[model samples]
Target: MILVIDNYDSFTFNLVQYLGELRSDIHVVKNDELSFAEVEALHPTHMVISPGPGLPQKAGMSLKLIEHFYQKFPILGVCLGHQAMAMVFGGSLKQAPTLFHGKTSRIYHEGKGILKNVENPFCAMRYHSWIIDHEKPIHSDIETIAYTEDNIPMAIQHKKYFVFGVQFHPESILTPEGKKILKNFLEISYDKAHPLH
Candidate 1:
C-alpha cells in the first residue's frame, strides 16, 4: 500500500490511475487530508509524497507529518515532496537555476541500482521554481543518488532507513524508465512486508 500525500488534483488523479496500470496490488490515497491520526490508523506499507504548485513555505507545509512518517515507513518523495523531505531533514531549498517548466530535464550525475538502465533521467511533467540544496554538514546516512550538471539534490537515500526521495516526478510521462524506479521503491517496502534476518 502507498499513501500519496499532496494537494494537486492532476498529479494525484494521474498517479492513482497510473499505479493501477503498473501494478495490481498498489494502493494510493489521492488526498492530503490524511491526518496524523488517520495515517497512524491505516499504517500503510509505503508512502509517496506528490508534487504541488507553490513553495514549501507557502504550500501545505506538513513538515511534522512528513517527519513522523519518514521515521516509520519507506517514503518516495517527488518534486515538492522531495523539497519537503530535504527541509525537514535539515536541508534547504531555493528557486531553481531557472523556471524549468518542461516535460523533461536531464540528470547528468551518477546513480546506482534504481536509476540504472535508463538512457536519460528525464522526468515527464514538472512545474516548480525551487530545488533542494543540502546543507554543508548533511546527515551522514543520506547519500545523494541523483543530480544535475550544476549539482542539485535530485535524489537521495538514507543508509539505514528505507526512506528515499527524488526531485523529479518519476510517475510522469517524460521519464523514460519511470516505472522501474517505482518498482525499486516498491521492492524496498516489500522488505517490511517480509522482514529478513
Candidate 2:
C-alpha cells in the first residue's frame, strides 16, 4: 500500500492520479485531519510525504508522522516534502542560492543505486525556492547522491533506512525520466545496497 500525506491540494490531487496510473495495485491514503496513529493503523508499505507551498522545513507539523514513516517504509519527499526530511532530521532549508521555480537548466546524473544502467545527462522539474545544503551535516546517516550542475544538493538518501528524498518533482512530466526513476526506487530496497568494498 502507498500513503501520501495531504499537503497542497491541487498538485497533490494530480500526483495521486499519476500514481494510480503507474500501478493499480498500489493503495493511496489521503491523510488529511487524521492523527498519525490513525494513519499508522492503516499500515502502509510505501509512503510518500506530500509537498506543500508552505514555509521551508517546519519544526512541528506532522513530525510524528514523518518520523513514523521514515522509521518503517520506503518514503519519498518532493519539494517541501524534501525540506521536511532535512529539517526533521538535523538539517534545514534556506532560500535558494538562486531561485529554481520552474525547471532546472542543467543537471548531471552520477552514482548508480536506482539510477544504475540509466542514462546520464537528465533534467527534472523544479518547484521550490529553497535548496538542501549537502555540505552541511543533517544526520550522520545522510548522504548526498544527486546535485545540481551549479553544485547544489538535489537528492539524498538515509544511510540505513528506506528513507529517500528528492528536491525535484519526479511526478511531473517536466522531468524527462522522472517516472522511470520513481519506478526504480519502488523496486529497489535498501536491503539490496552492498557494503563498501
Candidate 3:
C-alpha cells in the first residue's frame, strides 16, 4: 500500500491517479486528515509527500511528520515535499532568483539510482520558487543525484535509506518520460517490500 500525503497541491490528484494505475492499492489523505497513529493503522508500504504552494519551512506539521517517518519507510517527496525533505534533514532552502512555474529545464543527473535509464540532461518540468542550498552541509547519508545547469539541486536520495525527492514534477505533462521516473520509484518500493536477501 502507498500513503500519499497531500499538501493541497493542485497536482495531488494526478499523482494519486498515476500511482493507482501502477498499483491497485493506494491511499491519499490530506496532510492533516490523519494522525500519525491513524497513518500507522493504514500500514502504507510507502509514502509520497505531494507538492504545494508556498515555502516548506512554513509547513510545520507536515515537516515534523515527515521527519518522524524518514528512514522508517520509503518516501518520495515532490517539489514542496522535496524542499520539506531537505529542510527536515539539515539542508537549507532559499528563494530562487527566478520563479519556475510550468517551465522546462534540462536536468543533468547520474545515470543510476532513481534516475536509472533516465536520460542525462533530460528536460524536466519545474514548478517551485525555492531551491535547495547546495552550499549548506546536508546529512552525510544524503546524496545529490541531479542538478540544473545553474548548479541548483534538482534531485536527491538518502545514501543508506529508501528516501528520495525531486525538485521537478515527474507527473506533469511537460516532462518527457515522466512515467518512467515514477516507475523507477515504484520499483524501489517493490524491492524494499520483497528484498532479495
Candidate 4:
C-alpha cells in the first residue's frame, strides 16, 4: 500500500486521486496523526510526504517519521515534503527571492533518477515560498539533481537510496508531465517491494 501524509494542503486530494489512478492501495493520513508506530502498523509499501503549508522545520514529528522510515522503503517528497527531507537530512530552507503560488515555471533538470524519463526543461507547477539552500548541502548523503532557471534547487535525490524530493507539485494538472513523474516513483516503490522477483 502507498501512504501519503496530508499536510492540509488544498491539493491533497488531487495527489490522492492521482495515486489512486496508478494503484488502488493508496491511503492518506493527516500530518498530526503521523507516528512511527502507526506507520509501521499500516505496513505501507511506500510513503509520500505531501505538499503543505508553513516551514518544514515546524513539522518536527513528521520529519522524524521520514527519517525513521525512509530507509525502509522508497520515499518521495513533494514541495513541503522536499524541504522536510532536506531538514531531516541536515539541510536548510529559507524564503525564496520570489514566492510562487499556482504558477507554471520551466525547470531545467538533468533527467536523472525520478526525472529519468521526463523531458528536459519541463514546465512544472510552482507553489511555495521556501526553497532548499543549494549553496550549502548540510547532508552529505543528499544531492540536488535539478534546478530552476534562477538556480534554486528544483529537485533532489538521495546519493545512494530510492528516495527523492521535488520542489514542484507533480500531482498538479498544470505540470506538463506530472503523471509521468508520479508513475516513475510508483515504479521505484514497486521495484523495492518486489525485489528479486
**Model 1 lDDT-worst window of ten:** 188-197
Best-to-worst order by TM-score is: 4, 3, 2, 1
Per-residue alpha-carbon lDDT of candidate 3 for residues 62-94, written as tens digits (9 for 90 to 100)? 787778887577888999999988888899988
* Lowest lDDT 10-residue stretch of candidate 4: 188-197
lDDT of 4 by residue, 44-106 (tens): 988898888898766546687788988788889999998998888999888899989988899
List residue ranges in candidate 3 displaced over 4 A: 190-197
Q: 120-178 in candidate 2: lDDT tens per residue?
A: 66778888888876666788877777777787777777777767777887778888777
lDDT by residue (1-197, candidate 1, tens digit) is 66667656367666656666666655555344557888888778878777777755554535666778776878877777777777777777777777777646677544553565555555544567887765455667677878776676678776667777777777777775677777767666644542211
List the candidates ranked by lDDT, beginning with the highest. 4, 3, 2, 1
lDDT against the true structure, per candidate, is 0.67, 0.68, 0.83, 0.85
lDDT of 1 at 72: 82
Residue pairs with backbone overlap in model 2: none
| Candidate 1 ranges beyond 4 A from true positions | 25-32, 116-125, 134-137, 190-197
Please identify which of the two predictions, 1 or 2, would achieve the higher lDDT against the true structure. 2
Residue 165, model 4, lDDT: 92
Candidate 1 accuracy as TM-score: 0.82
C-alpha TM-score for every candidate: 0.82, 0.85, 0.92, 0.93
